[model samples]
Target: MTGLVEYAERHPWLTDAIVVAALLGSGVLGVHLVGPGDSRPEDVWVADAVTVVACLAVFGARTHPRATVVVTTVCAVVGGGLGFLLTPLLLAPVMVALYWLAVTTTSRTAWTYGAVTIVLVVGTAVGADIDETVALRSVGPALWLVLPLVMGSRSRLRDALLDAVRARAEHAERTRDDEARLRVTEERMRIARDLHDVVAHHLAVANAQAGTAAHLLRRSPELTQKVLADLQTTTSAVMLELRDTVGVLRNGGADEDGLEPAPGLARLPELIEACASAGLTVDVEVDGEPRELPAGIDLTAYRIVQEALTNATKYSASGSASLRLGYGARLIIAVANETRPGDPGAGRPGYGIVGMRERAHAVGGDLRVSDAGGRFEVVSSLPLHTPAATP
Candidate 1:
């Protein structure tokens, strides 16, 4: 039985083979017992032959269960004229075929088979010349046939429902996995850009400063010390920020110790000071009450200002930018700059702009970047609390 199940699992054809074999074997057995002292040999033989053909149809039961039931039922009805002896026990194969069909097909089909089974069994019992006791007892067996049919149909339905649920669960899991992979890929790309902007740029500046210090070390020790001190400050800041960012990733974001809080409107003064050191003058302004905002909004506000200032420094010859922050129900941030004439980078936006837009949108906000009358502006506004945070 285990071998048969294994074979059926591996090869669907085996299921059909088993059905055919069962029907044919049952037919032969029924045919052998159809003869008795109560029935004529010719009549018994004819009935047995018809039953054998009908039962043999069980071979294609799964493929054509309705047809098999129809054929077997008709044969069973006609064979009644030959008495119980001629009929043999060929009804067993018919019962098995009908029950299997009910189990595999829809409920409507099962109902139809059940109605037919009831009619045929009752008609066969009543039409035959069997004793009253035997005829009465036959009803029990006829009713028993319905148990397998109903139970089998129910079992198959349950299995199909379970399979559907499992399929949906697997599909959901696959979708989640795909989204996670995409997010990771984007994060890696962002990290690469940050490394280029922060680490590479600072390292280049530090190297230049160190070279200057070396060149003046003997002749102007005071100048050398100043240059070296600036280099040390720049290098140290880079190392600290790098350690924080990389450490966050390496530790799965659990390490907050050396990590600086994300820059926000609160850090605008420091940002202005930093711009001064870089020879860029920034005018910072704040309007409206500075209420505490959601973390996402705060982070987005900071990034918008940072990206705008960075672009201004890289592309504007005027070395002057304006940073504005306003808080109402929403936080608004805007950075505008006077673009440098003949600066190729002034007109084109890069991933920094894209990152700013993405950050704004991530917090259910909007970002707008445009050039107006030779001035470039990046504006972003984010709601303090989104629908998801309303609880």
Candidate 2:
């Protein structure tokens, strides 16, 4: 059914031919079946000729609706004037024209055109008094004319409603695609930040251990062995983290069981030992009772302290840093390290600091980095509890 409508739309001239055939066939049949019984041969010829002209006028109905209606209505009156009964079948051609007119134009235009045709056909049949029957002269022609106009208007309305529904569905599909793209972007950024933290912290500690081992190799061989052992531990730990980070690129996402427990505040002892191996001392302080923290906040807090001390190991004049954790209504974290002369004037922060800020904001918290007069400090506050759903 859909294919046939598309074909008709593509070839309008072919559609016009089909309509002319149906209307002409019905008109000729009506003339033979319902004409006057004692009609002359010439009267039959004239009535048939008028029917042919009316059917042909339907071709122009789609493009010139008003003109086509007038022509067909005039032809209908001419046929009725010649002692022919106004049967609906004989008026099929005029009805076809009105149907096309209604479908192609607005309701007001179609109604105005249909009313004029009805008035002309009915008034002429009654005025001529050629056919005396009440139904044939007055009722039949008016009733048939109105049917096609109603059908055409109904089809037009149905088509308009279908198009609106199709447009809405397309808009919803586009919205879903946009949301999917945004989610993918956020995931990519998270993986990049994690990769940076794992690589930077481990490499800094390993490099410091390797340098310390070289300095003590000839002077004291026993001390060099312990430094080399710490180097091996740092390398092994970094390799495991690197595999986990790379697994995200291999698989679309990490499965719950495939992941190790994420790094957080519980890992601080290891971070301090690694900094100790690098010849930097980290002093830990706690205010209020220390307790378990949310996974996201814990990981963010650990990364900030690790990054601050790692910077100190590479650049601090004092070679020592301070870490303070305050557990109150909100968890407060602060890490400070002494800076060398004219070091870190705070023009633009490095990727490590940027990553730390992004992690804090991701968990609905805030972090700030400041370099004030020989000291670099990172301070952040986080909500202790997440909103839970009620059963």
Candidate 3:
């Protein structure tokens, strides 16, 4: 069935040929039925010739709609003017032409041509003084002509509606693809931030512990051993975390037993111990009632503090910093450290501060960094309840 329809669509002229054959048969019948076969031979020949020309004109209606409608209407009126019966069969070609005109041309053009056709065809029939009733002379031709125009207009509207639906579906599919790409990009950036914070903070502490061990080697052998032990602990913990992170990437996910819990404020004591061994003393002060936080806010807070202390370890001349946390509608974190004019690591290029800010903002929070009054300070304000999707 589908193949047949496809074949018909491929040969469009076949449709015009079928319609023309039907019109010729009906025209012949209409002429013979005129007054008990009393139509003269000359009149019959002329009517048949005019009807054939009008039916042929139907073939061009799709290409030259207005011209085709005009030609068919003229032929139909000419046949009626020669004192022949004006029946619907005799006007079949004009009806077919009007239909194609409606389908191919604009509604305004089809209707304008239809009104002109009605005026010409009906006026010729009525003014010819035929024995046919008034209804046949005027209403019959108008009804026949109007049907094709109406059907053609409806076909055009349906086709336009289908095109609009197809276009909207395509646009939605493209939007879906764009949204998928955007999500992938955001995930990559989140992973980069997490890796930077985890690796940079741990490595800096390890480096500081190593330097301390070497500086104390000759003067304090026992303390050097303790620093070396702390160094070992730091490297071991970071390796386990690195493995955990990398294993997730390699295996698509971690097994339940293999997955390590992400770090949060509960792990701040461990961070304090590591920083103390690195010769950066962190004095932590809590201003409000401490409560457990949502995972996103907890992880973001931990990373911001870790990154800020790492910067202080690298850049501060004084080996002391203050860490403060306040809990209320929002969790407030502030880290301040003394800075001197000739701090050894003052002029280094790093993304630590930027990563910290990004982590804060990811949880619907904000971070501010300022170097004022001989001190460097990082203040972050985070909501206690963060969005579920934040990394």
Best by TM-score: 3
Q: Rate the local accuracy (lDDT) of all candidates.
A: 0.71, 0.83, 0.85
Best by lDDT: 3
Question: Predictions ranked by TM-score, top down?
Answer: 3, 1, 2
**Candidate 3 lDDT tens digits, 1-391:** 9997788779889976887889889987876666764654456788778888888888887788888888988888888877777778888888888888888888998899899898888898788456647766688777888889899999999989999999999999999999999999998888788788878888999999999999999999999999999999988988888888788778977899877677899999999888999999999999989999988789889999999899888777789999999998899999989888865555343588878888888789999888767788999999998666737
Q: Could you tell me how far off, in angstroms, the CA of residue 214 lies in candidate 1 after the best superposition? A: 14
Comparing 2 and 3 on TM-score, the stronger one: 3
Model 3 residue 117 lDDT score: 92
Candidate 2 lDDT over residue span 101-220, tens digit each: 888889999999899889988887677445557556677778889999999999888888888889988988998899999989998888778888889889999998999899999998
Q: Candidate 2 — worst ten consecutive residues by lDDT sum? A: 33-42
Q: Which regions of candidate 3 are displaced past 4 Å?
A: 8-42, 84-88, 115-133, 136-139, 340-349, 387-391
Q: Per-residue lDDT for 1-391 in model 1, tens only?
A: 9997778868866676666677667665655563434443456677767877776777767788888778877776666545543232667666766777876798888778878776776677566446756756466646666766777688788889999999999999999999999999988876765665566445645665676678888999997887777778878888987887777778877555655676666776765655554546888788997887766677667667766777776665677888888877777888888987667778586777877777778778999999868899988888888548545
Write down the lDDT that model 2 would get. 0.83
